[model samples]
Each structure stands twice: as structure tokens, then as C-alpha cells.
Target: MSNPDITTPVRRPRRLRTSQVMRDFVAETHLDPAQFVLPAFIAEGIDAPREISAMPGVYQHTETSLLKAAEEAVAAGVGSIDLFGVPTPEHKDASGSQAWAADGILNKGVAALRREFGDDLIVMADTCLDEFTDHGHCGVLTTDNWGHTVVDNDATLPLYATMAVSQARAGAHVVSPSGMMDGQIRVIRDALDAEGFEDVAILAYSAKYAGAFYGPFREAVGSTLQGDRKTYQQDPRNARESIMEVQLDIEEGADMVMVKPAMPYLDVLRQVADMSTVPVAAYQVSGEYAMITAAAQNGWISREPAILDSLTGIRRAGADIILTYWATEAAQLLA
Candidate 1:
């Protein structure tokens, strides 16, 4: 009987992972609070923070609570915050007038954060109609020749341009257009430049997908969605299309490009990161947060570690920035 000697080898991969210090030293990916972007909600009539049921520990905030959260995020070293508005049903119109109004909750929230933090924080606004529109669509709707209601892409572009200008005026350093409308970035960029807000950057949601993963977000925003966004948002089945979308956004002057629903679209994230000339971002959407939180609350997993690991995995997948509900907590944990 013969046996080969296996104790000695030409290489020892485990040597670097043998200890915590060793692992830290040899780590290829490192996460920083500055690489995280938190998305916050501002409700029109709310006087206090309202917790979202599906997303544990997340809230639809009032002006006061939104400012406090912004301050806390800064203290925790989180890089930026993205704001979404929840207007009352009475205020919503077919045009989503509140979205571009200077006094809109999201606009007011951005202004307050800018006033408080000045240049210390990066303030961002979601320049989309879904949160403000009665129909819960991302754009203006019109009847097509077939007598079917559809998003009027060209007509919506002007509204997006106006919303971007308003957000810039409200002190948002970045205006994220997540409507997935064609040529949205170009119209927005043109509008910003014309309004002398050339410094305000456009963060385009280039590869956002239509999926079940967005269910929790509807609740968080108080959405009255009647149907699916599948016609506008990218189909989950396409990968090559993501590259085309990212490229078009870049050419249209997007300062940053993003892939939405980070967990499921990680491959898309990687492709966008590789293809894009601008910084790449991945959104850990509401459903992703809800799933993890639900599992943790059920005692199936350790909450804090899972959060950190999820963010770390996204970072390792080539996302330059991660937009997550757990941004502040993760930043604090990383500290």
C-alpha cells in the first residue's frame, strides 16, 4: 500500500484566513461608511416618524425626524442620503405637481439637510413621479393609438427636467432619476445646465428591473399603484440590455449609473461597473431589506452580521456605492 504525503504543499491559501488580523490584512474588499448611501422617506403631513411594517427599523419620516436621521447619518460617517416624498392624496395630480414644488416634502427635506450639514453631507433627491403621482407610475400617462394607457415618454421628459431643476434648487447635490425613461439623463442634464446648476450631478438608475422585489417599497411610499411597472423597468431576463442602458446614460451625461435591486441584479451591477465610465451604484431595494429583517426578527439569523455581510457582498460585486436601508446602522457597525 502506498500513500502520498499531503501535509506539505506549494501554496497555503488558508494562511491568510487563519486569524482575524490576517483576514483583515489580506481582505481584497473594504467597506467604508462613505461608500454607503441611505434612502429616507419624508411624508407630507406626518408630524413624527412612521415605521414601515414590512421593513423593520425603517421609517417614513417627517421633517423633524428626517433632519435628525440626516444628522445621525453624518455622525455615523455615512456618505449621503437619498430622499423620497410621500404626498397626501389630495395634493397629488396627474402631473405630479408636488414633485417639483419647492415646498414639497422631499424638496423641503433636502433643503433642511443642506442647511444643517452644508457641505458636510451629500444630499440626494429622487426625481421621479411614482411617489407623487396618483397613478403610481414613474411618468405621465396618456392614451396610445391602441386606446391603451401608457407612459408618455417624451411628455414625461420635460417634467423630469423640471423636477431635477427643483431638486437642485432645494440643495440636492445629486438628483437621482429612477424612472427608467429613455433620454431622461440628457433632458435633466440640459435643464440643470441651463438653470446654472451644472454642478448638481445626475445619478441615473440605468438598469432598474421590474420584479417582485419592489413590493415593500410601495408600502414605504404609500403608493397607490394599480398595475405593474414592467413596461418601463427592465425585464429581469436581460443582461446585455443593462450595458446598453448604462452606456446611453453615460453618453447622456450621467455622473453616476446604478443597478437596482442589488441582490438579484448583482451580475447586472458587475456588468455596469465594468462598462460604465462613471461610478457604479447598486440599490439594495426595499424587499431585500424586508426579507433580511424578517428573517433576523424571526431568530433565524444574526441581524447585525447579516446586514454587514450583505453590504460587503454588494461591495465585492463591484458596486462603488451601495444604496441601502441599513446604511446608517452598517456604517456604525463598520466603525
Candidate 2:
């Protein structure tokens, strides 16, 4: 019996690994340009697009450049874009009022993209106040008796609702609420429904974490925040909390849910993707992009392949959509 068993193997696991085509044919995951949602920034005061030092090749685009870049991204086969704004210091206020203004730079960017693409591309506006607030907090702040400033959840919900309505009015196809404020999704949904913007979808950042991974983003947005957002953003130490957050957002009427800083939280993404009824998206945030770019720039790794591999890994983790700074370049490469 031992001689017979050693003489013949019943199955050969390496059969699928015989060639690239064979491996690809049996591959469980695939990537497509339409699966990517590009994250773009538009600055209110810049004459031309200015590159962020920490995030090389990513820019603080002027409104004009924003339209151009968005068009290029779409032309490269990217399916959608998520817009962020960087207000001039003078325009920033305690309330981040510009965030909901009709003429707000982010609103303008959304309008510009809508006009240029005309329903050809999915235009998403970032419904957050961090870029417009002088304090750089995602919500309104108040000083407690101990002189500690904390975000007022109730006060911020109304602002988020108002900002969401403004983005919808500006022709945004989707409003992504990333502030992580409690009840934000329901509030925005109610506000949008009341204003007859029921057509606009909500992509909630349901599992955003308070991590050091957001360091490069501060520079990209010109943040004024002196402290952290541990109170609102989820703690990375807990996985169950992420599932709870996703459930709450879904019940609140989120059309989609996202896991932020995708690579680090892929397990969380997997969990969310498995249970969520709606589409699950993942954000490959600024810091994530910076690290990969930095390593590539140093010649320590191949940039293009690494980008493709990272994106493939995210897709394999079960994300229906991926918001990344590499959307355009990756889309072109994949094509």
C-alpha cells in the first residue's frame, strides 16, 4: 500500500499554475477601470495646479485644471471621481460655511465635472467640512468646562445635511459623507429627499479609522487641526465596531459603504463586503498612496506593478469600488 500511494498522486495542485493564461483563467478576482473612483483636489486660490510635496504627482488643482484633469481621468476609462476642496485661509470659518455655499470651490468643481461629462461620468462630492474649517475638525466644535474642545454631533449633522444638499444642487451624482459624525447619513438622506434630490446616492465612509495613516492627507488639505479625531473615527483595535458602523449607515439609507485606508483594513473591508446589501467601496487614502509612491521613487520597488498588485489585492478583498489617487494611471495601464 505504501509503494502504491507513493507511486501515484491523485491530484496535482500545480496544474492551474502551468502558465500565466492558466493562472488567470482560474483567478478568483479581477480588476477593471470601471471599478475605480479617482480622488481629486481643487484649491480655491491657486493659479495653477500645485503638487503636494508629501504626495508626489498629486495636486491641489485650480478649478480650471480640475475640469481638465477630470476630463482626462474619464477619458482614460476611469468610471468616476470624488472631489475634495481646499478653501483659501480667508474663506475658512469656524462653521466651514463655504462647504455648503453655492459658489464653494468643491461645488464649482462638481458643477464643472457635470457640465463636461454630462452624465457620462459619475461625479461625487466629498460632503465633509474639514477642508473648509479653520479648526480643521470634521464637525463644529465647542469648548467644554475643562477647556477641551469636542465636536458637537448634533450641531454637525445639520451642517452635513446642508452640505449634502448643496452638492446635490451642484449636479453631484453622489455625495460621500466622510466626516464620521453620528447620524450624518440619515440626516443627509432626509435632507436630500426633502429637496427632491432623491436621485443622488450616498456613499458613506462607515469604517474610517483614527490612524497615523492620515498624516499626508493633512498636508494635502492644508489642515489646521492640532489634535486627533479619536472621538469620532473608529478605533483600529476593534473589528466588530466596523461591522456595527456599517450596519448603522445602511439602516440610515446609505447607498454605499466604504472602508478607509483600504490596504490596512482589508479584513474589515472583507467583513463589510460580505454582509452589506449595498455596494462596498474602499478608499486607498493619501498616506497609502504616498508610501507606495515614495518607495517607487526610491527605486526600491516597481511603481506600475506595485500599483496594479495593490489594486488587485483590494478587489480580491471584495470591494465593488475603489477610490484611489491612482485611478487614472491605473485605468490606462489596465487598458
Candidate 3:
């Protein structure tokens, strides 16, 4: 039935996509449980785990519940858990002193996890003062020369150094400085070394942006933030600025760097990955989780597939590690 003058087309790409097994065999991007990191919140005095209303299925856990969550994540093959401590209002002060106390909730959580997991899981502490500060700013506030109250970056460095040492003493394998303060990495790194925690690593939030995606995170941590953090955190519109930040962190002894609010900034993530010599991490922030959950609950999308796809996309965009609220479920799904 074919004309002699017309040769049949030979390149049919659909032949490779004929079946699921075939697709799997040729898949370029993949996800693994070992690449997932769970971000957990442990409140000081709560007797039971309280589910965050804005972020359904995520909780502000008690110490008991936090251990249980870690056990589940470990069993599912999740690689790491980053702990955020929520202090009682009475414990909060201008300097966020509780942040560096040995008995502090965060340090306690770190010690407990170290005793239980004992290197089975990587324990990371959020080495910032936001959750422990009355003002809910990431650092100490001061009146600048212009009479504007702003986060004092220079003054915050020493506090971060002390906090990192405290977390290291409590057996945290890594201390993540999420305050986005300049010179923090060098200070924390030097302090950890001086305190005999040279083995401990620093995960710098190098490219954290000032975005509205952190709303649910504020509720989860019981944040008392007065205004905004735009003065320190990078503007969402700028892409090249992230490179400068990442480079500075690396130069300051950052073991790894993170790009937060993963999906909206995949372009930045990709660019960072291409140039950086160290491993790259991305955070699937609370708002990203909330929106997907809400839409799926309304039957707008298939929840499981959407979660997997979103995670896969991040991996394809060049993230070596992904900090996500869905870590346990996603790990189980992959398993």
C-alpha cells in the first residue's frame, strides 16, 4: 500500500514509551528515600502532638511524638531530620538565651535523638533564634543610623556561633543556620571547631528568599514576628544574587547549601547546582505543601502522583537533598 517514492519513517520515539516497564528502563531522573530529609517541630511543653491547622497532616510534636516520628522516618529509610524548637513565651527573651542552653527544648531533642538513633539518622538543629525570640526575628533587633529597626547582622553572628556550639555539644551531626545573616557560616564553623565539634557540619541556608510561602511555617513554630525579614532575606525577583550568597557561604566553610521554597525557585536551584562544588539542597516549604494538600482534598488532583511528580521535578532540577514535610509518606511510596 506504500508508494515506492515515499520511504517509511524509521524514528518512532513512542516505541520507547510503549509500556511502564519500558519507561522505567529509560528514566533519566529518579528519587530515593536516602535523598529525603524531614523537617520536624518540637514544642517545649506540649503533652501531645498538635496538628498544624494551616498545614494539615503536619504537627508541632511533643518530645515523645517527635521520637515516634523519627522512628517512622527511619524505618521508611528517610536520611535525616532537622529539628526546630518552639519555646514557651516565658522562656523567650530579647537575646533568645534559651537557644544556647543545654536543657533547651531543641538541644534536648537533639540529645534524645542522638541517644536513640546513635548515628542511624543524621540529626540537624536549626541554629537560629526566631522560635526562641519574643520578637520572632531571626536575630537581635537594633536601631540603625537611619532610625529604622532592623535585624542586626553583625551582632547576630556571635549568638549564632554560640547556638551552633550548643547544638554540637548536644550531639547534632549538623547545625543549619537559617537566619540568612552574613558572616554566620564562618562564625559558626569556627565556634564548632573551637568547641571540639570539628566533626560537625554546617548546612547554610544560602539562598533563602523573602517570600510569602512561609505562612504555615510561622503557625507551626508559633512565630511572633512583628513585620517582615525582607532586609536580610533575598528578594524573590533576583536570580544572580543567589550565586553570590552560595559562593560566600562555601568560602566561609559551609558543608552544604540550601535553596528554600523549592518549586518557585527551581531555576535558581538549577543554576546553583551547575556551579557549586558542594552538594545542593532544596526545601519544599510549608505553603507549597498546604496548596497541594488543599487542592487534592478538593479532588482537583491525584494526591499521591502529584507528590511524587513534584519531588521528581525537584530532583531533575539538580537537588541532591530535599527537605520536605512529605518525606515519610514519599519514602514509603518509593519503597
lDDT of each: 0.92, 0.93, 0.95
Candidate 3, residues 1-335: lDDT per residue as tens digits? Answer: 85665565667789889999999999999998898999999998889999999999999988889999999999999999999999999999998999999999999999999999999999999999999999999999999899999999999999999999999999999999999999999999999999889999999999999998999999999999999999999999999999999999999999999999899999999999999989999999999999999999999999999999999999999999999999999999988
Supply the TM-score for candidate 3: 0.98
Per-candidate clashes, comma-separated: 0, 0, 0
For model 3, the superposed segments whose C-alpha errors exceed 4 Å read: 1-8
Error of 3 at 31 (Å): 0.4
Measured on C-alpha atoms, candidate 2 has an lDDT of 0.93
Q: Estimate each model's TM-score.
A: 0.97, 0.96, 0.98
Error of 2 at 302 (Å): 1.4
Q: Give lDDT: candidate 2, residue 214.
A: 86
* TM-score, candidate number 2: 0.96
- Sorted by lDDT (best first), the order is 3, 2, 1
Worst 10 residues of 1 by lDDT: 1-10
Over the stretch 77-153, how does candidate 1's per-residue lDDT look in tens digits?
Answer: 99999999999999888888899999887888899989999999999999999988899999989999999899999
Candidate 2 lDDT over residue span 293-323, tens digit each: 9999999999999999999999999899999
